[model samples]
Target: MTDLVLGPLLRHVGEHTAAIWVETADPAEVTVTAGEHQASARTFRVHGHHYALITLDGLEKGTKTPYQVESDGELVWPLEPSIYPDSVIATFDHEKPLRMAFGSCRTSVSHDSAGNKLHGVDSLRAYALRMSGVTDTDHEGDPDPGPGMRWPDFVLFLGDQVYADETSTEMQTFIEARRDVREPPWAELKDYAEYAQLYKVAWSDPVNRWLLSTVPSAMIFDDHDIRDDWNTSLAWKQEMEATTWWHGRIVSGLASYWVYQHLGNLAPEEREQDDIWQRINSHDGADEFDATDLLDEFADRADQEPESYRWSFTHDLGSQARLVVIDSRAARVLDTENRSMLDDSEMAWLDEQLRGDVDHLLIGTSLPFLLTPGLHYVEAFTEALAEGAWGQRWTDIGERMRQGIDLEHWAAFQDGFHKVSDMVLEVARGERGRAPETVTFLSGDVHHSYVSEARSPRKAARRRPRQQSRIIQAVCSPIRNQLPTGERIGARLAAYWIAGPIGRLMVKSAKVPTAPLRWKLLRGPWFDNNLATLEVLPHGLRMWWASGKVEDGVHHRPRLITVADVTIDKPTKETR
Candidate 1:
């Protein structure tokens, strides 16, 4: 039997359809069975590895059905008499409230005492233990299971699902065995084989694997998935492009990402529209379409052109919320003369999706749209300085500082930031359709969790009698990786005091136009490794941050600890 290698991951579950993704040991016909509905697809080869994405249709809407995967007609998943709960596909229901879990920056490591001591506890694993009813005690500080007793509609993994640059000891061992450790790119992933192995390490943990199987998930890539500060600026890109192995690294990174992460993010219709998918679907059944060449070419072209293909996707969550997950990292325009977080086409696409009508509008970017006011201003200031705001002599130093300190947020891309901010303001004013109850940006990659509220004096001046939608930014980060103590302290001070005033002064002195909105931190700069859940309510939006806490010195198995709870109140008629 060709045993399942990577996943039985439930992806893109709709009202009457569900997509199940899996990888096998070899080429085989993979069958997924949910209740009486069954679908099968042949595994397609890519770099000698086989993968299949099975789409199940004609299912009842708003129903939950336990699903099982079979390789070559032999049952391989939900291994007979499983100790964990059977993985189920839960379709979306408009009548029910929508809830989602989101976070970023996780590293895969052994979930033992050593890993906990080194990386703090793994919040996602702790959550999985809770969901499986394996954890017994709440423990004094443990978080209460919030709103829904049922599973969330889906989980949004904003970015850094796998760390290609910062490999663990285990990954390093694998690399050393295959390639010369002294070579360029060193321990970083060099090609598709390494990336495939990296993914197996990230997903093979039994508890985490179970969680993925049950929870329908969507994902986007951030810097670490390719390399640190990937596409941060033209300088960084040029430096890497000159390297011998950088080409292979990037091609493999994007190609593996397409197979492991991006493919599952697309729905049936969306997949049909994909150029690569069309090639895969057109195969005449005589031989498998080895996507290695096509993917390599596509990745090369995408890296060179930025607008060849779109990686962003949107999900309409049953009239309750609309999720627009943007590709902030891959689709960046890094030309020094035209520095932008997104290209014009991407920005326009985002604007088109930034409409009202849904109860809650969520824009999921790997990087937070709104940082703490202080940090946001600092980024804006740095961008101006980098662009010769200070003087010709300071330009080089400023550019170095921008890349070194990672001042590459949305704020750093001033033009793009302002354009999107205007779109958000218009959407809030009901210029699109009915104003959403909340326009919230769901993000991660800052390595800290926080909530910030945008207060626009300009918007307030033009405000009508109609209630304006609540504009907020919610961030959850480091589901596994913990920030260093010194960096944590620095982040706290920079966000709270040092950065805002000084950065604002610099921007004003540079003669840059004032921002349309002003924002301030409402909740945190918490450094704990965390996962956040957001629930859309009729009146407003409720979000909670949870972390893994080792209780009573049991370092191996941590309990879920509540970090913070926030509520964004909908504007009432009286308040308006």
Candidate 2:
């Protein structure tokens, strides 16, 4: 009997269609049944694993329908005697408001006290417990959706879905058990099999598993998804290329990412356009068609020639809300002489997407575009110093300092920053089509949570930028990963009132030009394992942060608790 290996992850949910992703133990026909609608697909083999993405169509819009999975004619989903509710396919209504949950930088670890001690708590798991409402381990009562409880229409994982460099204790043991730790790449993942195992470890936790099986999700990659400082610069890339193991590591990273994450990020039509899916979908008379070589070659070319394929994508939600998720890590122009966070082609694509006419424009980037003014200036200064502003001697010092603290953010690539900022300003000032209620940047990577509101500069730095809609940058990071106490001090200090002027002066000394959009940290730089959700309201927007609190003895099940909240109303006056 064929069995499910990993998931039935809900993805690319539309008004009338949805995609279900799964990995089976063997090559088989996987079917997803939602009410009278049923869809099945033959499993495709990649790196010896059998996977299928079943696209279910012809469903009623804005309705909730319970779904089930069967592999090789055997019922598999809704695990026997399960305490959780039946997994449902929820299609959103286009006329309703949009709500979404988002965060990044989660490291898979145990839910025991030890894991909680090392890493605070898994916010995602807590959310599942809340949504699932399973009091005991045994099957008894049915799930209670709770009174007036609002579930997110979708969830976005900004980046660092996996930590390639910082392997957990469990991950290290898995690697050490198979091969000697003394080998090149050491405990780090070296190939596709290792990457597969790592992803299984990350997702197989029963609590988070149920959450994934139900809620539809979208994802992108950041530095740790491949390595610590991937694509920081051409020099860094050259250094890694000289290593014997980097080629294999990178190829496996991209390949696994394509199967495990990127495949589901695409819509039905978009998936058909993918060369990989084209091959997977066109399988005929196959003893499970293998795509190992094909995927590896694609991965290799993607890294070498980023312009050949695009990773960034956009999703339209509700009647006039749009979500644009950017790929900040991989699609970079790393040359120091003309460094940018995105290449020309990627920038052009983004240019086409960042227009107006939307009620709300949500920009999702792994790195926060608007860092607190103090920290934003700090990154800008370091970048300029590293680019020979203080001579070759200081450049060496600057480069070391930048990488040691990981100073590669939007500010580090000012050209790309200016380009995006111009688009944002234009959208905000009604230059696009009609002005949006808000032009917001949602991000997670900094290992802290904060809210910053942007305003046009009183003295025009270069070009005058007027604002009609409120512009905000909200950051919620480290869903599981926790920062060291010492590092937290540096993060908190950067947001101090005095640090802003000091950082600005340093940027000026380094010849950093004045910024068109000036922002102030409105809420926090709180260091906690937090997950945040945002809701588009009639007048404006409302966002709140939540964390997991494992009370006294019930360490296994952490209860969900509120953290902080932010409410943004319309901007009435030109305070700038």
Candidate 3:
């Protein structure tokens, strides 16, 4: 019997359909059964590894059913009388409240006391223990689930699910044993095999594995998923392109990402639209579809021409909300003369998706749109300087500094930033139909977490009776990783003091136009390893951050602790 290598990860749960993704040691027929209904798919081969994404249809809306996975007609998941709870597939309900858990920058590490001490506790693992009905006898501070509160409807893994650039100790050991550690690219991943191994390490923890099986999840990638400061600018790209191993690394990264992360993000219809999916579906031979060459060509083309493919996706949650997960990394236009966070087609797509009429409008980007006012201005300042705002003499130095300091964000691309901000403002003001209750930008990339709000001072002075939607920036990060003490303190000070005044002055000196809206930090710069949950309520939006805390001298079993809670009002004429 071949053991499963990766997942039974539940993905893309719609009203009547769900997709489960899995990886196995060899080519096998994978099946998913929920009650009397079942769906099966043949594993597709990529670089000799096997994967399948099984889509189950004809499900009742809002129904939660226990499910099992079988490979080669043998029950491989949910072993008989399992200690963990049954894995479930929960369909969407239009009338039900929407709640989603989100965070970024999780590392794959051990779950013992020493591992916890080094990397901080894993919040997702703690939540898994709670969901599985494990008694927290060792943890005194674990929050009891309130009456009738179930697990979040789904989870939005914002970005950096795996750290490809920053290899773990174990990964480094494996690389050194297999090849020369002194080679180009060093300890970083070089090909598909390494990436597959990295993912196995990340998802193999028992508690987290079970959590993934039961909960529907959606994900997008950030810089670390490829490399640190990936595509920061034309110069960075050129430098990487010159390396002997970078081409292989990037091609492998994108190809593996498509199979592991991006495929499950699509509905069956969407999958049918994908070229790779079509190739897999069209294959008729008994053996799996070996897609190594096809995937390599596709990845190379995508890298050479960023506009050739679209990685962004949109999901409407049955009139309650619209989720637009933007591809901030792969779709970048890094030409220094025409630097844009997104290419023209990607920008147009985002513009169309950021509309109104829903209760919530969610814009999920890996990078924060509303950075601390100070940091926002600093990034803008660097962008202007990079563009020779001060003088041509400093242009090259400014560009170097920009890439070195990792200052490329939404604010850095002023044109793109202004365009999206204008669209957001219009949506908030009901220019594109009924304004949503909130226009929230959900982001993670920076290791810190915070909440901020944007307001147009002109609207406040006019005293308009029409209800204007609130504009919010909600950030959650580092589900496992924690910043070093010195870096943390420096970041806090910069956000609080230096970035604000100095950054603003720099922008003014550069003669850049003022932003359409003013924003300020509302909640935090917490450095804890946390995951946040946002719930759409009848009145407004409620969000809280949770962290894993060691209790009663049992560090292995960390308890979930609430870090902060925030409520945004759903503005109405009566309330105004």
- The TM-score values for the models, in the order shown, are 0.96, 0.96, 0.96
Write down the TM-score for model 3: 0.96
lDDT of 3 by residue, 79-161 (tens): 66667888999999978988889989999878888788778899888877767766343222223363224788889988889
Q: Each candidate: what lDDT? A: 0.86, 0.86, 0.86
Worst 10 contiguous positions by lDDT, candidate 1: 139-148
- Alpha-carbon error at 54 in model 1, in Å? 0.2
Runs of candidate 3 exceeding 4 Å displacement = 137-149, 457-467, 572-576
- 219-332, model 2: which lDDT tens digit per residue? 999999999989877768998999989999999999999999999999888999999889878978657778899999999999999988889998978656899999998899
Given candidate 2, what's the lDDT at residue 104? 94
Per-residue lDDT over 1-576 for candidate 1, one digit per residue giving the tens place of the 0 to 100 score: 699998999999889999999989988888999999999988888899999999999988888899889998999999776668889999988778888999999998878888877778899988887777667655233334532245678999999999999999999999999989898788889999999999999998888899999999999999999999898778789999999999999999999999999999998999999999889877868665688799989989988888989999998786789999999998888877888889999998998999999888999999999987767778888888888888889888878988988999998888889999888888888888998888899999989998988756645646643437878899999899998898899877877778878777877887776787777778887889998888877778888888878878886567777788888888775433
| C-alpha-based local distance difference test score of model 3 | 0.86
